[model samples]
Target chain A: MNPFSYARASDVADAIRQIAADPAARFVAGGTNLIDLMKYDVEHPARLIDISQLPLKSIEETPEGGLLIGAMVPNSDLAYHPLIEQRYPLLASAILAGASQQLRNMASTGGNLLQRTRCFYFYDVVTPCNKRKPGSGCSAISGVNRINAILGTSDACIATHPSDMCVALAALDARVHVAGPGGARTVAFPDFHRLPGATPERDTNLESDEIITGIEIPAKGFNANYSYLKIRDRLSYAFALVSVAAALELEGDTIKEARLALGGVAHKPWRDPAAEAAMRGQHAGESAFTKAADLLLQGAQGYGHNNFKIGLARRAIVRTLSQAARGMPQSQSVKKIR
Target chain B: MAQPGTAEPLRQTDVLPEKIQITLTVNGTRTGLAVAPWTTLLDALRDRLDLTGTKKGCDHGQCGACTVLVDGRRINSCLTLAVMKDGAEVTTVEGLASNGTLHPLQQAFIDHDAFQCGYCTSGQICSAAGLIAEGKARTADEIRELMSGNICRCGAYPNIVAAIQQAMERS
Candidate 1:
């Protein structure tokens, strides 16, 4: 890692002011992702603003019938919080399914959301990747395209967002609160991450000097019947090959409302509004889920190694919806769709 | 405080420089030192403090070869800076044995033949100790998940799991 100046901020204001003063400054919270990038020489910040001592480590109930999670809250705490487990079981499960105990203990909520892609090409300095080095050719396209993105991808980049928690957050319609030089602002979870359009170098909509203060998620009535399914090559400590986060609200065997998001398939958590729209008013069955998944993956383009992900993602959606629907009350059970 | 030729001008250099005083209590002893701004806790413990029991496998937080405890909470020491942990109590593998007696987990590992080359043994032991403290070894699935970060290229996972389970039962 390159030499860098470090300063432990006294408070949130001090952290923000210090970062705003230096363009090359970065806030180090958990250091789970940032330190990895630094070791690989991918992220070379001149100044590291340590904000681990900030008083933003709580999980409180907001006035608007939602949960406000502080940015500094560790992933382990969030995964095991009683409120999160009771109200947002999908989020808890998603957090548990990611990384490992040691990593989850060290990774904060804000750090998890801001984590970069785990693209092999991006991490390997010998390879050329536009996301790692601007204007550099993408080596994953012609080399190993197995773990690359199949949706929301561009010719310049095909890296998938490697986060399971963000997939659940996208499905739950959470909101991110950030503080920067311009002041505090809220960005919806879906819009917080940007696709690699012409510039794959930029990951999120966060400004260079922005600090994520907290994440807010409005209470969902259907959270009681939610599920997060992540399929990976190994049973533990591995990124997902195809994952789905789904919540269902059923009205006497028919779908009243549904929210679905796919991970390991797109540049960001792929929220399929069309799939959600198709599930409404329809019976909660495998056929309905299959059709909706097909619609969601209509324009999916995959390479030779990852073509199986489309089918895996479709099946994952069906299985998740089925499981979530089964967990609902008896009155919600209707005719099972084949 | 009015001196002209003071202290050789502090030797100016291009490297971004900042020194922070860190006082760590390790294995029942208090030690103080000035570490560079970017020095990780693992480096401080291993290189500066001469605690070579903690290994550095994948320096990028992927491997658990540098797992340590700060105030009873387990963390990837390689991902944390030593200066950021001033006055914190750290427990490494070197501190596991007490009064010349091996810890239960360490004894179980040796009895079960949990490791082959023993490169990742110290980390596995430290991480397993923390895992037991956190109640992560309740079930086989939970044990596998909790110990996932510590890789054993010798494919000693089955024995490692057995050793951990035996130690947990004894504790």
Candidate 2:
């Protein structure tokens, strides 16, 4: 890590102003991902504006009966928050299934959304990576890419976003609240993260000067059944090879509404409304689920090593949807797809 | 007088050009130190403060060998900057034992033979200590899931789980 001047932001305005003034400065929240990148020489900031001390640490109830989660709220706190566990258990389960206790204690909600891909080539400075350095040829395109992206990938980059919480939030219709030099704006979860198109260096649609202040999870009617299932190499402390967040609203045995999002397969949290629509008014069973799974993985073109993820993701969707339909507890959601 | 939770203003001369002076309440002792912005909390504890109980297995936060308590929460100290945690109370493995007595987790580790090489012991114990405080680990499976951050390459997981369960029952 290079030497940098550190300043703690007293408020949101101060954080934005400080970062806007220096293009070389970056906000340091949680430091779980940023510090790791700095150590790997993938990121080198001249100044660090510490936003951890800011007042954005509350997880509160909005006037509309929805939840407003502060950006600086630790992952563990958000995961175990009474309102989150009760109302948005899928988000809670995804978080707990992503990282271990120690990491969850340090990682923040906003930072988790901005976490970089875990692609080996992106971190290895010696190797050429377009995501790490624009115009630098992507090594993962020709190198080991078992964990690479299979959806929303471009010729420039094939890195997948490694966030399980965001996958659930995508299914729950969450919005990101950001403040920047222009003004404050709300970005829908789908638009917040950008696919690795021409400019793979930028992971999010967030401007360089903007600071993520909070996340707003709108009060949704689909609260009957939900499941977040993560399939990884290990039972714990490993990134998801393929994960599914399935939430269903059913009338008796027929699905009235549904939301499906996938992780470990796309540049962003992969959500297809068509797949969700296929389940409407249909019986919540294998046939309907298999149809939705097929629609969800329709254009999922996989890299060589990660071709197995295509099949793994399809089965995971089926299993997670089954669990959600039965209203099984989220504890049974964490499984290793073989 | 400043507000209770408000942070103190940055003093230019406190850093001596590149190093900044920050107060950290480590092991219940309030101490002031100066360090560069790049210095990790693990380095501050081991190199500057001479508290070497926390081992650095992988400084990238992948391995939990550098686990320490900040505000009673276990975090990989290697991943956090020392300057970022001014005014926070940090507890390392050295702080676990009090007044010449071993912490219950430490005692249980010995009783259950929870370690082989023991490089990751302090971190494992510290992480287990934090887990115990959270009061979420009810069964051996839950304990294993929660404590998955701390890696025991020596393969003493069975004993480690046994020790944590024994400690949880006693408490």
Candidate 3:
């Protein structure tokens, strides 16, 4: 990692001021992803504004009957929090599904959203990764891409957003709260992450100067019938190969409403409101799920090594929806599909 | 306790550069040290403080060989910058024992023979300590899932889980 100057931010305004002043500076919150990138020579910042001490570690109930999670809330704490575990169990399951116990303890909420879209090449600076260097050409497009994106792909990049929590957030319709020099703004969760359309370097719509303050989700958490199913090479401590976040508001056997999102197969958490609309009023069964899966996987093309992901994603979407519909949310502990 | 020359300039130059001065309460003692911005907590414990018990397997957060308790929460020390945890209490494997008696988990590890190389033992123990404290795991399956971060190449998982179960029961 490059040597850098460190200054602890006194408050949110101070952090914004410090970052806005220097183009080469970056905020260090959990430092889980940023530090690893620095060590790999993928990211080098001249000045690191430490925001770990900032007062943003609270998880509170919003007046709108939703939840407002502070950006600095550790993944482990967020996963085990009473409100999250009880109300937003989908989010809890997603958090526990990704990484290990030690990482979840160190990683923060906002930093998880900003984690880079990566294949194996992104971690090695020696490889030609377009996401790391724009217009430099994407190696995963032609090389090994077992973990590359299948849904949203550009010639410039085909890497997937390796975040299970974001998939759940996308399904829940969460909002990202950020504070910049201009003012505070809430970005819709889907709009927060950008597709790798010729610009894979920019992962999210968040500006360099804007600091994420909190993540807000409205009242409907889909607590009764929601599931976060992560398919990976290992049972745990690995990135998802094809993960599904399925939430349904079911009236008896008929679906009242539905929210479906896919991770590890797209530049961002892949979601289509139209496909979810197709599930409404239909019986929650394999036929309804297969049609929704087909709509979600529309135009999903895959590289040579990752062509299997197309079919895997389809089956995973169906299985995950089946699990949610049966009210048997996938367990993070017992990872084997039942 | 404040050591005599520990406070000396890290660069020893007439003109001072940017090594930030901070205090870390490791185990039970509060030691003052000046560290660079990029200095990780694992390096600080092993190099500066001579607390080599916290091993550094993967400098990245992928390996749990550098697990330690910061402010009573278990986190990967290798990923944490020393400056980021300025005033925090860091409990390494060296601090697991008290007054010549090993921590119950440490004792259970020996009884179960949960390691072969023992390089990942410190991290596993520290992680297990945090896991038991979290009170979220009650069964062997839950222990296996929660302790998945600490990899044992020796494949001593069965014994490790057994050791953790005994420790949990004792606690």
Candidate 4:
């Protein structure tokens, strides 16, 4: 690893000031992702501002009937919290489906959200990847395109964001709270991650000095019937080939509302407003779920090797939505609409 | 590729840099060390304290070859800074045995033939101990999920699972 100055911050304000003092400084919480990048020579920070001691590890009820999750809360703690398990089980399930127990115990919520993609080309110093080094080129476009993005991708980069928590958060309409030299501000979960446009290097909208303070998820009626389904080649510790996080609000037999997001298929959490719009006022059946899933995958473009991902993602979304709807205690047998 | 530990010293100052003083309680004994800030907990335990039970398969966090218990919770010590943990309790594979008697997990592992190369056995044993402490090995799926971080290149997952189950049954 590269040699750098390290300082443990006593408080959140001190940590913000430390990062603001140096543009090349980075805040280290879990060190699961950043430390690996540093060792691989992909990232070389001049200074490391350690904020693990900051009092940001809490989960509490907000004033607006929502849950406020502190940024420093470990993944294991969040996944096992009683309130989270009862109210938002999808979030708990999503966190559990990521990494492993050891990594979850050490990984923090803030660090998980800020994790970079696991693109093989991006990690290899010899390969050309725009996300790792701007303007070099993206070898993933033609090489090992199986795990590359099928939506919200550009010619410059085809990498997908490797996060399960963000997929659930995006579906649940969470808000990210950030604090920096300019004070505090809140960004909607969907707006937190930026698409790979001209600047593929920038993953999120956060500034260099900004620090994530907490995330707030508003209480919704559909959360009780939420589910997260991740489809991968192996069972555990592998990135999702295609994942779906969905919440269904059923008014007897009719669908009142639906929240859906797709992961491992886009540059960010692919939340489809059209799918949500189509699912409203429709009957809770296979046709409704399949139509909504088809609407979401309408614009997905697949490479030669990744053409199967489209079908796999479509099936995953349909299955997750059907499962969410079936949680409403109805013995209804619906035909397959695919 | 450069040799694992033979990369040219980035900073060529012969005089060792200023060392941060820290006291770590390993197993049950307290040991003090003055090490560089960049030194990881894995290197501190294996190189300085002579606790070589913690292996270093991948210096990065991709492999769980350096998993250790930090105050009863499992963490990748290769990714943790030694100076960050002060007066913290750490447990490695060497700490599992007591009075020349192997721990139940170790005994079960031997009986079940859980490892082949034995290079990743230390980390696997330490990680399994921490997993049981954290109540993570409840179901077979949970055991597989919790143990996914520790990879056995020899493909000894079935025997590893059996060893953990045997230890759980004994407990």
Top candidate (TM-score) = 3
Residue pairs in clash, model 2: B15-B19
What 10-residue stretch in candidate 2 chain A is worst by lDDT? Answer: A329-338
The full ranking of all candidates by lDDT, starting with the best, is 3, 2, 4, 1
Candidate 3: where are CA atoms >4 Å away? B1-17
- Per-residue lDDT tens digits for candidate 3, residues B1-171, read 112212212222244338989999999899999998889999999999999999999898887999999998899998999999989998999998999999999999999999999999999999999999999999888999999999899999999999999999999
Model 1 achieves a DockQ score of 0.31
Error of 4 at A336 (Å): 20
- Candidate lDDT values, in order: 0.85, 0.90, 0.91, 0.85
> Who is ahead in lDDT, 1 or 2?
2
lDDT measured at residue A282 in model 4 versus the true structure, 0 to 100 = 97
- lDDT per residue for candidate 1 within B31-150, as digits (tens), equals 999998879999999999999999899887777888888888778899888878889899999898999999999999999999999988988998899889987458765787778889
Stronger candidate by TM-score (1 vs 3): 3
Report the error of model 2 at residue A224, Å.
3.5
Ranking by DockQ: 4, 3, 2, 1
Each model's backbone clash number: 0, 1, 0, 0
Model 4, chain B only, scores a TM-score of: 0.89
TM-score between model 3 and native: 0.96
Query: Candidate 2: where is the Cα deviation over 4 Å?
Result: A221-223, A330-338, B1-17
